[model samples]
Target chain A: MAGKQQQRLPREVRERQMIDAAVRVFSQVGYHTASVEEIAGAAGISKPMVYIYLGSKERLFTACIHREADRVVETVRAAVHPDEPPELGLWSGLRVFFRFVADNRDSWTVLYQHARTQGEPFAKEVRAARNRVIAEITAMVVAGTRMPGGERIVSERDAEILARIAIGAADSLSDWLLEHPDESPDSLVDRVTDLALVGVERYNTGDLPPS
Target chain B: MAGKQQQRLPREVRERQMIDAAVRVFSQVGYHTASVEEIAGAAGISKPMVYIYLGSKERLFTACIHREADRVVETVRAAVHPDEPPELGLWSGLRVFFRFVADNRDSWTVLYQHARTQGEPFAKEVRAARNRVIAEITAMVVAGTRMPGGERIVSERDAEILARIAIGAADSLSDWLLEHPDESPDSLVDRVTDLALVGVERYNTGDLPPS
Candidate 1:
């Protein structure tokens, strides 16, 4: 016990611990319902130490949002290859997104549910994160329209609309999946990709080969 | 003056006055933010009379939600045909949806923003109203698919997914449009319809159609 106690954690390790705690707390109680003392308790640290590590509650909440938002964005980005056809790229990106959410329900809840209801600044952070996700989806749609040999290219406005629909489907499905945890990400992603591709297909030639 | 002061209002006249007053108060201060007193004052009635007419705050809120939800659902339902192909039905439905929101911004906001965030029983009411919209959209998707088109036929699961996506996109766009009041519903609906049709066309055909 004494030896274990002496093995101090690294700075990065401690910072991650605090953020993980913050995410869990925020997810459960929401922003207004959560308190600094509760977060400190959840982190297995003293209130003063938590204050020293993360500063104010607002900063701590933002830190959690940033970290989770970055993870979500990075996962989606890494899953897709820009060089690939838009349909396949979008398929991969969606698979990564569902998998990430399935693995991190707490973080998703914290980011989607708790943050949006916090009002003002917190709402803005949530919107920014949401905008990033939508933007990534939009890029994939744009790429699909610009594929070589593709005809009847989608207009920018139309592409944006498609992007919004795709994002909405993904989001609403994610919320539904949370309630029905048994559904596989592969199945969900497969259906969504099929549906999304259908939406953009009319804008391109119906018989065009995949790029 | 004596005749007007002594006259008793008809039931329909009083009910209309209460609803009009309620919409104004609820829209301005939100359901939770708006007080019964304010609503009564806006209606030019005493607090006791207001309570006698509408019961408690919860009852009043439910009344408001019921009226607005019915109006929205009825408007969209009238625009969509269960027999028509899904794409055309969805396009018509979307136009009606945007029109309803555009025409009754405050009522829509009351149902969507204020009630949705309050959680629990109220959210369920909103969800049911939302499901009606989704159900109509789902029916359209189902109608679009053919029996011989068995493999590509719209599954109930997929139809639900499509409905969710369509509804979410329309709802989010409406929310965004509320802030940018200069945007006309006709132009926005046209773009959204095009985008939705693109997806539907893609679903109908495996890939992009040849030009």
Candidate 2:
């Protein structure tokens, strides 16, 4: 009956099941201690089938990182509306990001904190993910700096700098968020929004240089 | 003659030489590729002596991390004066930190960029080092929030958030500094200081919440 059920499912569906189980096991026991047999058992499949689907434990972990990274980037991107003012877009994006992390603590742990320390291909994957997010943010910030007259308030370089600062602060605060489980994501957004408002106010006042 | 010099030197001096040589070799070839023989040869000592002095390759790397972490914390601490305003103190500390990374690129790479990805004891050491720096910044920020009339404007929690932002920005910017070799530490400091000033101005205007 199990074999019949497995044969009925497409390879993609089976692969997803394997990855889902892999993320749970990896997050619980961590990469070093997690076993392929355990993951296969959790997914209700044979060990050989698990290997056939994902190739190996290392590849399985990498797949988890890639999938989770995509989810995070997509979540933030979706939260931001291009028509809204840049500050509001940034605020909304941050709110969703924190919510995502809080909701998917397991995925977050596996994707970021664990994968980062695992070295090699995992670290490379994490860096690539981060660069993608930075690029998206750079675009948003650059767009925000433009005036109705087509004048640019912040230079491209400064815009990139701001994006880097925003991402760094977000990354650091995510770790803080994980540590303080009692604190809600909305409260964090409020605190950060309050802090960012000061700088945004200055930018609006022409305190920043023109590009 | 080498034997005679080895006998003449104290244990601490010999250990320092080994660590210095280890830092250079590790930075050049990375931790995995670095061999004790090369480090010993660079330090003009025997491989057996290297093991005797530092136990194993792992311990040697740990020692390098400890020494360099101390150097960074001390350099930044020395630059920050308690009597100065918090903003100036932060600026000066950041300046020295970038200078330290610029002057000792090898140390920074081995201590931060490398050790962080190596996992296990190395990652633990890196976290401990970061915590120490954060604590120092938090204290400075808390002090900065005090008014001349003995009133506090920012709450302790808010002060911690400020410190995290500052450190996260500094950490992220340091990577940017390394990537852009043409940019000087002072130039990076100037850009960051400009951004920080806007927020500081807001804080001065009583825009933030009072404790």
Candidate 3:
């Protein structure tokens, strides 16, 4: 197995392998301590090959964030059917999100922990990735409430806040997923969806209960 | 001021000065790059004085987290009126939280960024502090809903989720505070409280309307 070099593999397959290995190492030891050499070694490729494929440790880290971020955003996009009830669609999207986090611990770690830990370039990459997901959520939120007979729950800006709230729930629940490894993603998804959607409805109805 | 050496100061005053300086240095550079010597220099004290006052770098970092966490918790505890309705209490708590973050950006940076970036001991310290706040929120949530005639919207476990949602909102809003430095904490507080409490109410009433 050692004699068959990973470099001999197709570029796409080889790059994926490097990213897979990179995520593991970065998550385990964290950003500052992880090295390109270690990532390449874990990928079973030469350091120069890693450099050629990914350029630098920084770029490799950014690529991992980009890939995982795309995976999460795309997962939600594919899961939500435009025609479904907004709550059901929201449930689906959130379930997809938790499942993605549950199944992809290494990926989640890269997107949340490592990416933001690095300075400006990488942190901005994470922010952009997150903003994309927030954008998707925001658009859905605007659609769900702005329709005829629908409750105008939140303002344009408030919709943006709800989008962040959803992201925050997903982010916090992702941590829960890590700790409660035996928990089902569907259950957690229901928990988060109920909390988030209910709040939006209350806000729309102006149900700010008096203390 | 130069004539009065920090070493000549009383223990209480000197310790506070050192922790204040540590927050600045740790926030400026990442934790791994921050040093006791640099912190001491920032504090206008000797290196040995820092060690004598705070024990070790690890202990010093832990102390910073502890101090900042105490400040936040105490701020909320002091600001909240025990007799106020649950929704109002939560609003007060969140408002104090955003105000704390805004006023003490350096301290917030230390708690949110630096402390977590360090390894297990430091991370555990941060976790404990956060858990304290979550515990406070959870207890309030349980009390608010468990009352007679109040909508028993959520289970004990669901109450736990509500606590986290509040935290998630505060966490994201803190980032927003960093970008929009001029924004008033009162306005942000109102925005967050409405979203959070309204959601809690909806949850209590089982207001899961058809999406």
Best candidate per lDDT, number? 2
Q: Give the CAPRI rating of model 1.
A: acceptable
Ranking by TM-score: 2, 1, 3
Model 2's DockQ score: 0.33
Give residue A40's lDDT in candidate 2 (0 to 100): 98
Give me the displacement of residue B84 in model 3, in angstroms. Answer: 4.9
lDDT of 2 at A157: 71
Specify the CAPRI tier of model 2: acceptable
Residue A44 local lDDT, model 1: 87
Q: Cα deviation in Å at residue A58, candidate 3?
A: 5.1
Q: After superposition, how far is residue A207 of candidate 1 from its true place, in Å?
A: 17
Writing each residue's lDDT as its tens digit, candidate 1 over B1-211 gives 7666545455557766877888888888877788989988898888898888888888778777877888888888888777665766667777778888889887788766767666556667777888887786777787676566466556887888888877877777777667668877888876765554555555456563211
What TM-score fits each model? 0.77, 0.88, 0.75
Candidate 1 residue B135 C-alpha distance from true site, Å: 3.7
Candidates' C-alpha lDDT: 0.74, 0.82, 0.76
Best by the DockQ measure = 2
What is the number of backbone collisions in each predicted candidate, taken in the order shown? 13, 0, 3
Q: Candidate 1, after superposition: displacement of residue B113 in Å?
A: 2.9
lDDT of 2 by residue, B30-64 (tens): 89999989999999999999999999989999999
DockQ of all predictions against the true structure, Cα-based = 0.25, 0.33, 0.26
The residue-by-residue lDDT of candidate 1 on A124-183, one tens digit each, is 787788788878777777877774676546776556656666566677778767877778
TM-score of candidate 1 chain A against the true chain A: 0.75
Error of 1 at B62 (Å): 4.2
